[model samples]
Target: MQAIVVEQITKSYGAKGAVKALDGISLSVAKGELFGIIGPDGAGKTSLLRILATLILPDAGEAYLQNLHVVRDYKRLRSLLGYMPGRFSLYQDLSVQENLSFFAAVFGTRIEDNYDLIKDIYVQLEPFKNRRAGALSGGMKQKLALCCALIHKPEVLLLDEPGTGVDPVSRKEFWDMLQRLKSWGITILVSTPNMDEAELCDRVALLHNGRILAMDTPAGIRGSYERPLFAVRSDEMYRLIQDLRQWPGAYSCYAFGEYAHLALQQSLQGFDTQADSVMAELQQYLESRHHTGIEVLRAEPGVEDCFIASTKDR
Candidate 1:
């Protein structure tokens, strides 16, 4: 059974219909599956989550959580889903235990009644149980927020960029905790801007500018990349890009890390004379003009590389 189903979901804001936050987005999360929405800032991930959580209504389309209509049965839906918003929305003045208790109470439950559901996470906060949530570290606050969300034992979890603002170590630990949570048969739908985190999900949808570029497993997405790319770097970086772009056979070129990734227009041309012929001509042209320290090597495409390539195509 599908835990969550969104069909043709769309949202917009401003008087002139200025911003289109979500645009005809449709997706489904299977029961007990970990689905990810991978996108950068302002990609409408939060807007979609809010709609699913029944905190916001979509301008069009419909959504269901565990077969319950999000809009029609919002009151009942609230009792069956856990949501951790992008921002830390927990009360700062409340102690860790108090916040958990309050959220549990809201759903007609007590901390003790569901302590086993969150014991692994709650213990870490137990040492600071009496401390005000405002004074906790970024990682600790993340943990507390999650505990509160899970206190009611919801069937689905919606997390929006849960790793943002936390240290790398804490981010890794948080994802590890999510893996453990999956064994409990709770469906998880998480949104993140980090490319590395996208690999952890069972499947991911890459979003850009309120549109989905692709949706598939990490390996499957990577396997779809077909072009041969090269990383070219030089001490005279500006001149290298300028010269490379002007090269006759170059199809596309862009800066990546410390090197410029270049896609050639023609691949069959041998690098020895045809490809190297162009490079040597450019090198000599550069050397004649007093350029120095050029390096170019063939490189395999990574997730970031594929993302850039896909965006460029769009």
Candidate 2:
């Protein structure tokens, strides 16, 4: 059986249910598979994770973790699930060791019972075992939270934006830890707004406006961009993007790091779109716009590129 299953789940908040958090969203995760829910803020990533964590019930449809229904079998499922919420929710006054011990006791387990499960992580926190959780660095706090969640050796882990507020190096370290945990047969469903992180997941679901825009491996998601893509940069970066967006043949144009990635429409009215001719014409057009230092090169589609195009298409 699949490790996690969600079918046609929906949620809304506010008076008369004016806000729709999820719109018939459905997906599943295989045993030990690392699945990602990728999207920006207000895209319902938190709501979806919360439902799976059994923090709240979905308005319609059903969800199951390890074949235990999220609603009906929440009590049973809780013992098998480890959740690290986006925000730090641990007791501020308690030291790291105290917090870990408290959570283990709550679950009726001793820290030694699952020492092997979290030893790799706790070593880093051991030096600061007496430091209050609230006083720890952002990254340390995340590590402590993760350690608490894993104290019971849950079969499935739900990490909600564990990278947020942490430094880039810490973020990388955290993901590496996750990769290690997956090897131990734990199903992981992590949610993040960082598009770059999507590549690390075995599969990802791109979500926006309370709905899934696309779901596939990172390579598969990039392959969905059927248009010709190019990276263009010039002396006037700001003006270059404006001109590219206004260009007649432009299908999608947006800033990407040092260059603005432009996806061209294959066919444009009275425009010769043959690759060679298109590149030459684009240069000529930018030159005419009084933009100097122009450089345009065909570019491969990245997860971020595909994300923007998908959002526009939807």
TM-score of each: 0.88, 0.96
lDDT of 2 by residue, 99-204 (tens): 9999999989999999999999999999999999989999999999999999999999999999899999999999999999998999999999999999999999
Q: Please report, in order, the local distance difference test score of every candidate based on alpha carbons.
A: 0.86, 0.93
The reply for model 1, stretches above 4 Å from the true place, is 236-244, 265-295
What are the per-residue Cα lDDT tens digits for candidate 1 across 138-251? 999999999999998889999999999999998988888888899889999999999889888988888887778888888888777666667888897877888778777677
Q: Which residue pairs come into collision in candidate 1?
A: none
Error of 2 at 193 (Å): 0.4
Task: Please report, as a residue range, the 10-residue window in candidate 1 with the lowest summed lDDT.
Answer: 267-276
lDDT, candidate 2, at 139: 94
